[model samples]
Target: MSNIFTEAEIAYLESQPLGRLATVGPGGRPHVAPVGVFYDPQADAVVVAGHAGSGFGGSRKFRDAQAHPEVAYVVDDLASLDPWQPRGIEIRGTAETFSDGGEELGARITGVMPFDAAWLRIRACRVLAWGIDGDSFELSARDVA
Candidate 1:
């Protein structure tokens, strides 16, 4: 498979520090949270971190991932200027949760999460990017990296 992100797409994604992460919850409900996100060019993944005791809902996202990895995350730029609108990204991928300490992935999350926060990181296994206006495209992690 090819990468889902282009040079411009990657740059755009990285430029945004906040995004709404969606995860399926009980009864197929969707839980969305605004999180600090970072894109790793080498890993070809988007990483999000949370505190160990953050909230039941946050942990639910991981459970949803374990139960069903199929997930979608949104990162968009919202502006109120001449452009009149902002661009956005919708990344669809298998979600994975890792808690082991000291690995590079863990460190990356630590860097982004609050100092007192424990880490629950979500790495984008696959990404599908689209423009809010209507244009859309998809890219695999490999290609994105």
Candidate 2:
């Protein structure tokens, strides 16, 4: 219904290149892994390139997302070690797997993977952010488009 990301949140997303993606696997198991991520402002979603894996046909994250679209992704950092200021955003959304020609990859993550990678696009349903706006935080449940 409204954009869950503020100007600062978007800036943070742009500044960060890595995030943790969490997904559910068989037997109700939770799987989380570090991944290269980029925020697609045009899509209003987080984009992650899928790496080819030996057993799963794609990365574990891709398979997990395919099986269970509901997932959570977080990108965070310690803004101040002494003051203990932790800044980050958690995105809860449904993931959609698709093929990409690698054109969407940005310079921030281009050297991290190969071209023609599969992609997981997470459309945000809820967003929670903290320390992104000088210690202010908020949660948005409406569709962010």
Number of clashes recorded per candidate: 5, 1
Deviation of model 2 at 67, angstroms: 0.8
* CA-lDDT, candidates in order: 0.59, 0.75
Candidate topping lDDT: 2
Candidate No. with top TM-score: 2
Deviation in Å, model 1, residue 2 alpha carbon: 8.6
Residues 1-145, model 1: lDDT tens digits: 1155667667777678788878787788888878765676655667665544454234666567666666678887754456555567777766666544424554554454432133334455555555532443322233232
Worst 10 residues of 1 by lDDT: 136-145
- Local accuracy of candidate 2 as per-residue lDDT tens digits, 31-61: 9999866777666678877543322236788
